[model samples]
Target chain A: MVSITSSRLVRGREARRAAPALERPGVAWAIPGLVFFILFAIVPMAGVVYLSLTRWDGLSTPQFTGLHNWWRFFSDGQILQSTLVTAVLLVGNILVQAPISILLGVWSAGYQRNRAVLSTIFFFPLLLSTAATAVMWRQLLDPNFGIPPKLADLLGGNTDLLGGQKGAIACLIVVTSWQFIPFHTLIYQGAARAIPLTLYQAAAIDGAGRVRQFFHITLPQLRNSIITSTTFMVVGGLTAFDIVLLLTNGGPGTDTSILPFAMYQTAFRTYDYGYASVIASFLLLLATGASLLLVKISGYDKMTSTMEGL
Target chain B: MRRRRNVVAGFAAFAWLLVIGVPLYALVNTAIQPESKYTDGGPVSIPSAVTLDNFRTVIHSGFLHYVWNTVLVAALTVAIVLLLGVPISYAVVRGRGWMTRGVFRLFLLGLAVPSQAVIIPLFLLINRLGLYDSLWGIALPTAAFALPVSVLVLSGGMRDISASLYEAMALDGARPARILVNLVIPLSRSSIATTCVFTALQAWNGFLFPLIMTQSNDTKLVPLGLYNFVSQYGGNVPALLAAVLMSAVPILIVYLFARRALVMGLMGAGGK
Candidate 1:
C-alpha cells in the first residue's frame, strides 16, 4: 500500500510539472481584452494613420491626397499658433504648477495631523468634471458678477480674464493648474512621506534648519515624483481640450485654441477629416516623443521597479 | 521658532481654504439661493431665502434622463473594464512567455495613444457600425482608453500576491481559472475597487467622445447636458448652477466613500 501511494504521488508531481506547458490558458484569459483593445484602440489608430493620407469628407469617398494634409499643416498659421499655445501651456505648467504643488505637498506632509482634511479640500476640484469646472470658472470670471471681477472691482481695475487673448490663455493655465494641482500634490506628498524620518532627525542633529533640510533631503528625494508629475502635466497640457473648449471654445477668436481643439474644430466644423487626422497624428507623435524623453531622462525603469515594490 | 511655524502653517491652511473653499462656496451658494437673489445681490450676497425651485426646474426639464444615461454608461463601462482588466492582468502576471510580455507591452502602448489622437477615426468607426448617438458607442471607447491603466494597476496588485500562494494552489490540483477566482480576485480586491472607481469616473466625466459620437438630446450625458444647459439657460445662472450641483453630487459622494482607494490608485498610476 505504501509503494502504491508513493508511485501515485510521483505521477501527480510529474503531471503538475507538465501542466503549465500544455495548458496555454493565458491565451484564452487574455483574448477578450485583446479583442476589445484591437477593435477600439489599435484598429482605430490604424484608421487614423490611413485617413491621414486621404482627403475624405464624411459624406464622400476618401480620395488619396498623398502629403497634401501634411503640407497644409506646415503652412497653416492657425495650426502653428495652436501648437505655440499648447507649448506655452506646457511650459507654464512646468514652471508655475509644479513648484506650487510641491510646496503645498511639503507643507501638507509637515502637518501630518491635518493631512487628510487638507488633501480632501485640495483634491475636490479633481473630482469635478471638466465641464462643471469650466462652467464654475466661467461664472466666477464673469466680467459683471463673477468673483474675479468682484475682486477686480475691489482692487479698482477692469480685468476680463477670459475675454482677451493673453488673459484667456492665462486663465486657462490657472484653471487647469487649479484642477490638477491636487493630483500632483498627492504624488509629492506620498514621496515626501516615504523619506526616512531618520534622515530628517539626522539633519536636525547636524544643525540643519527646515529650509536647509527641505532643499537638501526632500527635493532630492522627490526627484522621481517631480519628473512623473511634470510628465503628466506636459502630456495633459498638450492634450488639453475639454476645459479650453467649454470655457473659451478656443475663442475670443482662436486665442486659447490648442492643437487638439484645432483638430476638433477642423474635423467637426470644417469637415476636413484628412487634415484633422494629420493634426491628430502630429499631436500623437509629439506626446509620445516628449513622454519617452521625459521617462528616459527620469530613469523610468528604476521608478517602475520601486513602484512595483510598493 | 515653533510659534512662527504654527503661524505659517495656519496661514497655509487658511490659504487652502480660500483656494478650494471659495469655489465650492460659490457653487453651493449660487445653487441654494433664488434667481432674484442672484440677480439682485449678485453672487456675493447672502441668501435670505433658500429654495429648491432651481432643482425643481432642472428636474422638470428632463435632467433625470441625462443622469440616468450617465449612470448607465458609467456602470457598464466599469463592468466591462473589471471583467477584462482583472483576467488579463492575472494572465500577464502569472503567465510566462514572450506572448504575455508582448501583450503587456501592447496594453502599455494604449496609454501613449490618447483618445484625442484617435478620436477622428473612432468617430468614423462608430458611424460605420451604426452605433452613433448611442450610449454604448460612448461607453465602448471609454472602456478601451481606460483599460491600459486598469490593467497596469491590477497587474501591479496581482504581482504583490505571493508566489507561495500560487504554488500552494497549484499543488492542490487547482486550474488557472480556479486559482484566479479563489485566490487572485479576493487578494486584489482593493485594486479591483480602485479600477472600478477610476473607470467609472472616466466614463462619468467623458466629454469629447460623447460630444463627437452622440448627437441627439436623448443620448446626452451629464457633461454634454451641462454644456447645453449653459447655452439654453445662459441667463438663468441659479438654475444652471443647480444642474451643475446635482450632476456633481453623486460622484462627490462616491469619492467621499472611496477616498483612500481613489488616492492610492491615482498614486499607483502616477508612480507607474
Candidate 2:
C-alpha cells in the first residue's frame, strides 16, 4: 500500500510536469469567446426574465408590473391554445419525420448507384433556407393555383389547405417534414455507415433474415443517431416560427399559432414587449429543459468537458 | 421471396423519390415558364415556353443586393466563429481550470436555446448598442448563436489530437499558440472545415434575427428578402419562385464543386 501510494504520487508529479505544455492555456483563452457569447446570448436570456415582470412597449420605460404577464399567460385561453398547438406540432413533426428518415437513412447507406443518386437529390432541400422553402411551399399550397386542386384525390378533396385548423396544421407538418427529413436522414446515414459488417454477418449466420436482421441489429445500432436526430426535431419543433410566420402566419383565427409565433406576433406586431417577454421566458424554460434533458440522457455533459478535468 | 421484397422496397423508395422530386421539379418548371402560362399547365405540367425573364427580374429588383448582404453576413459569421471558437475550444480541451470548464458548460447549455426565444431582449440590446438596422446587428447575434455548435464541433475535434503531438511541440520550447498552429490546427483541418461549412450555413440560412433586427433594403438578407417578396410578388408566382431558386444556387454550386468535402462537413454536424 505504501509503495502504491508513492508510485501514484510520483506518476502524478510526472503527469503534471508533462501536461503543462498543453494545459498552460489559462481561462483567459476562453474569455473573449465567453464574453461575446455571454453578451449576446446569456445576457439576453437573463433580460427576458427581468423584462417579463415589467409592462413595456417599445417607446415607453419598462414599468414594473409584478408578474402581470405571467398571470395573464396562465389565465389566457389563447396562450393555453398556443401551448397545445405547440405540443401538437412537436409531436406531429417527430412522428412524421423520424420513421421516414430512419428508413431512408438505412437504405441510402447502400453503395448502390441509385441510392447514391437519390440521396444526393434528397439533400437539395437542406440547401434552401427555411424561409425560402416555406415561401415555395406557400405558393404550392395556394388554393386557386397551386397543387392542391390538381391532387384533390390524394388530399381528401380539401382545396382550401390553409383555411381550416387541421388542414393548416397538416400543411405546416408536411412542409416541415419535407424540409428537415433529409438532414435527419444524413445523420442516420452516417450512423448506419459506421455500423459494422461483422454484426450483419453474425446475424446472417444465426439465420436472421433481412427484416429480422434490420429489426434486431440495424435498429439497435441506430440508437444514438435516433436520440440525436429526435433531439434536433424536438428543439427545432418548439421554436418553429419562421415557417409558421411565412406559411400560416397563425391564420384561420390563430388556429395554427405555436408558442414562438405567439411570442413573435405579440412582441413585434402588437408591440407588447412585456407580454412577449413572458412568452419568451416560457420558451426559454422549455428549451433549456430540453437541452438539459438531452445532456443528461445522451451523456453529452460527460462527453466533452469531463474529458479534461481529473 | 427475395425478389419480391426487393420489388416492394424499390416501389416504396420510388414513391418517396416522387414526393421529393415533384416539388423540386415544380420549382424549376414554374421558374422557367412564362408567368402567363403558369396556371394553364398547373405545377407539374411541361412548360409551353421557357423564359429567363423571371431570373433577370429577380436580379434587377435588388435580389443581387440581398444575396451580397447574405454573403457578407455569412463571411463575418464564419470569421467570428473561427477566431473565437478555436481558442475557446482549445482552452476547453487543454486548460485545467474550473473557469474553462464552466464556459464549456455554458456553451453546452446554449446548444438548444433557440434564437427566436431571445428576440425581445436581443432587439433591445442591439438597439441600445445602436446596431439595430446594421449588418453588424445580424452578424454579431448570429455569430453568438452559432458559437455553441462551432465550439461543440471544434472542441470535439481538438480533443482527438494525441497528447504526444502536443508534448513533442512543447519539447522544442513551443508555447500554446505555436503548438496550436503547428500541431492542433493541422490535425484539426477536417473539423475546421466542418466548422466553416456549418457556421456559414447557419449564418447564411439565418432568418429570425435578420427579420426582427433589420428592415431596410441595405441589410436585407435573402431569406427575409424572400419573405417580403411573398407580398410584393404575391401575384407574380413565377418571379418569386425564381428568386427562391436563386437563393439556393450558391449552395448548389458548392455541392456540385466540392461535393465530397461538403458532405463530410455536413455529416460532422449530425454525428455529434
Candidate 3:
C-alpha cells in the first residue's frame, strides 16, 4: 500500500513536469497586457509621484516644491477634516451597512422564489447611474419640496432630513449603502450557498438554535467574504466621488467633501496641480495601505490556497 | 422542512423588495408630475398627470447633442478597451517570467488608486497630449483607466481554458494567433461580454474624467452632459428629471437586458 501511494505521487509529479513542456507556448497569452499596464499604469503612476513633488499649474513647467505641498497638506485643517469625513463615511458604510446586508443576504439565500424578487428590487439602485439616483433622491430629500418632511408630517410632525449638518452626510451614507447592499447580498449569498447543508443538519442534531448556529457556523465561515466586501466598501468610500458630487457637491458648504472630492477641488476647482498631486499621493497611500491591510486581515494563506479554483 | 424556511424567506424578501422599489417609484413619479408639483414637492404619493411634455422639453433643449456626444464616447471607450484589452490580457495570462507577473500587479495598483487622486496629473497629461475637447481625448483616458479591470477579467477567463486544447491545436501546426482566435476567443465570450458591459457602464456614467478632461459639448459624455444640465437649470426640477431620464435610458436599457451578468460582473470585478 505504501509503495502504491508513493508510485502514484511520483506519477503525479511526472505528469505536472511534462504537461507544460508538451503544452503550446503560453507567452502570447500574457505579454500584451503586461506591456500595456507597464506603459500606461506604472509609468503614469511614476509620473504622478514625480508631479506630487513639484509646483505646476498643469500647463506651465513644473517647479520643484521640495515638500512644500506635503507640508501644506499635513498642516491644512480642511484636509484633516475631509480625511475625517471620509473615514466616517467609510466606517459608517462598513459598520452600518455590512450587518444589514448579511442579515438580508442570509434571508434571501434561504428561499428560491423570494430570492428572485428580493434580488431584483435590491439591485435597482445598482442599475441607476449615480447621477440619476442622486438627483432622484435629492428631490426626495428636499426641505421645501421633498418627501421626508411630508412623510414626517403624515406621521403627525414635520422634520427635514436633508437640511441638517450631519443629515446630508448620513443621507450620502444611506444612498451608498442602498446601492451597495445588493452587491454585498449577492456576494454573501454566493458564499452562503457554497456552505454545506450537512453542517446545518449537524447543528440541528446538536439542538443548536438558529442564532447559535449562525454565530458558530455561518459567521465564522464567512470571514473571507465579509472582509472582502468590507474592503471594497472602505476603498469605495475613501474614493467616494459621484454620489457626493451629484447629491450635495460636498455641500451644505463643503461639509461632505471626502478625500476624492478634496482632490477634485484642489485640482480643477483650485487649479493647483502640485497640491492636487500631493493630495492624490496621500489618497494613494491611504487606499493602498487599506487594501494591503484587508489582504492581511482576510488571511492571505487561505485566500491564496483557495484562489486557484475561484 | 424547506416549506417552513421558504415562508420566512419569502416575507424577508418581500420587505427587501419594498425598500428598493419605493424610491424608484418616487423617482419615476416625480419626472411625470407638473413643475409646480415638483417644486412644491412633498411626499410624492402618485403622479398627478402623465406628460411627455417634460421629455419633449428636455429633447428640445438641445440635450440631443449631449446625448449623442455621450453615446459616441461610451462606444469609443468600449471599442478601445476591447481592442487593446484583449491582446494585453492574452499576454498577461500566457506569457512567461516574473516581469509578466510584476506588470500584472501594476494593474492591480490601478484598482486601489482611484481616478480622483490622479485627476490633476491626468488632466495635464490629456491637455499636453493635445487631446483636450476631443471625443478621443475622453475615450483615451477612460480606456487607459479601464484597462486594468478589463485585462484582469479577460486574463482570469483565459486561465480557465485547458492547456491541452491549445496544445492540440499547436500539434496540428496551427499558429499561435489561430489558436487564440479559435480557442481563447470562443472560451472567453461570457467574460468579454461582462467586461464590455462594465467598461461601457463606467464610461457612460463617468463624470469627473469628462468634467476635467473635456471643456465643451464637443467631447462631453452623458454624465458631463447631465452635470451641465444641473448646473444650468437644476432648479427646473421636472426638466432636470427629464434630462436625467434621457441620459439614463441607454444604460438602463443595457442594464435591463444584462442585469444578472452586469450585477454579478460588477461584484466580481470589484471584489478582486
Highest TM-score against the true fold, candidate: 2
Over 4 Å off, model 2: A1-23, A304-310, B1-5, B264-268
Interface RMSD of each: 2.6, 2.5, 3.1
Q: Residue-wise lDDT of candidate 1 within A134-245, one digit each (tens)? A: 8888887888877765678564685677778888888888788878888888888878888888998888889888789889999999988888888788778878899998
Tell me the deviation in Å of residue A123 in model 2: 1.3
Tens digits of per-residue lDDT for model 2 on A108-152?
888778889888888888888899899999989898888899988
lDDT value, residue A207 of candidate 1: 89
Candidate 3: regions farther than 4 A off = A1-36, A153-160, A294-310, B5-15, B39-41, B270-272
TM-score of chain A of each: 0.88, 0.90, 0.86
Q: For model 1, what is the C-alpha lDDT against the true structure?
A: 0.84
- Span of ten consecutive residues with least summed lDDT in model 1 chain A: A300-309
- CAPRI band for model 3: acceptable
Positional deviation of residue B103's Cα in model 1 after best superposition, in angstroms: 1.1
Predicted chain A of candidate 2: TM-score: 0.90
Each candidate's fnat: 0.54, 0.74, 0.52
Worst window of 10 by summed lDDT in candidate 1 chain B: B1-10
